[model samples]
Target: MEIKIDDLQGSGIIRLLEEHLADMHATSPAESVHALDVKALQHPSITFWSAAEGNSVLGCVALKSLSCDHGEIKSMRTSGAARNRGVATKLLNHLIADAKSRGFKQLSLETGTQAFFSAAHGLYAKHGFVDCEPFGDYQPDPNSKFMTLVLEQ
Candidate 1:
């Protein structure tokens, strides 16, 4: 699979992101949903990428700078047809490597506390993310679960 920075203008990625947003909204209330929209993901502090094979998009992930030494994972999603093929794993590993290369000392993420998010939670834990209090601009929310991994320099 080819993974590279995304332009956010591709129809395939746009559709995938829309579906992801709709799914999140349906599973959680608006107040508890923190997923960024297309516009928000395009901010200067955020770097987005897509995994693809030929013309088919496989998965996508984003890293958002929280501070000079910290970053947050955002909008991680794998296409339905691409599930179970290690696409999400590859994208995640890529993001982690990118963070390290950029001199980030830590990486963090916030995911839902619902069944729909169990797999994601497990994935993060497998990669060394430990439970943590809300970071950055986040406040404590019962519906949210935050995790962080301190990168070795």
Candidate 2:
């Protein structure tokens, strides 16, 4: 699959992101859903990417610049058809490498505490991320689990 920066205008990717937002809301309280919508993902601080294999969007991920040396992983989703095919893994590895290249000292993310997010917890753990206290503008919440990876340059 070819992984590259996306313009976020294509139907396949738009649909994928919509589905991602839907799932996030369904699994978490409305006030707790931090997943960005299409417009939010298009903000200047965020860089969005989509993985595609010949027009089929395999997955997508985004990196939001939280500061000069820190970033937050956002919108990590693998298409249903691409699940278990290493799509999420590839997207995450790509995002991490991009963060490293950009001289980011750390990368962080927030996922739900529900069982629906267990796979995401495992994936982040496998990449050396560890549990962390709320960072940025986040506050303590029982429904949210935060993780961070300190990029070793």
Candidate 3:
């Protein structure tokens, strides 16, 4: 799989992001769904990436800069056909390394507490992320689980 920065203009990526938003809404209430739209992903503070094989998009992830020493993970999704193939894992590892290289002291993310997101929680835990209080503009919500990994400088 070839993973690289994406412009968020390709139809494939647009469609995938739409699907991601749809899934988030389906899994959580509208107010609880923090997944960003494609337009939001294009903001100057966000870096987007796509994983592909040949011309087929396999997965995508984005890293959003929260501060000089902090970053947030966003828009992590793997194609339905590519689940369990390490697509999200590779994208996450790539983002973590990039965050460290960029001098970020912490990487944080928010996910759902539902069973639908249990795998995600497990994945983050496997990567050494520990539970944390809400960060950024987030508030305490029973439906939301926050995790963070502190990077060694």
The most accurate candidate by lDDT is 2
Clashing pairs in 1: none
RMSD of 3: 0.7
Residue 80: error of model 1 in Å?
0.6
lDDT of 1 by residue, 17-65 (tens): 9989999999888998999999999999999999999989898999999
Model 3 stretches astray by more than 4 angstroms: none
Clash number for candidate 1:
0
TM-score of 2: 0.98
Please give the CA lDDT of all the candidate structures.
0.94, 0.96, 0.95
Question: Tens digits of per-residue lDDT for model 3 on 17-104?
Answer: 9999999999998889999998899999999999999878999999999999999999999999899999989999999999999999
Candidate 2, superposed: residue stretches over 4 Å from native: none
lDDT-based ranking, best first? 2, 3, 1
The lDDT, on a scale of 0 to 1, for candidate 1 is 0.94
lDDT of 3: 0.95
Once fitted onto the true fold, the runs of candidate 1 whose alpha carbons sit more than 4 angstroms away are none
Taking the tens digit of each residue's C-alpha lDDT, what string does model 2 give over 24-142?
Answer: 99999998999998999999999999999998999999999999999999999999999999999999999999999999999999999999999999999999999999999999899
Where's the lowest-lDDT run of ten residues in candidate 2? 30-39
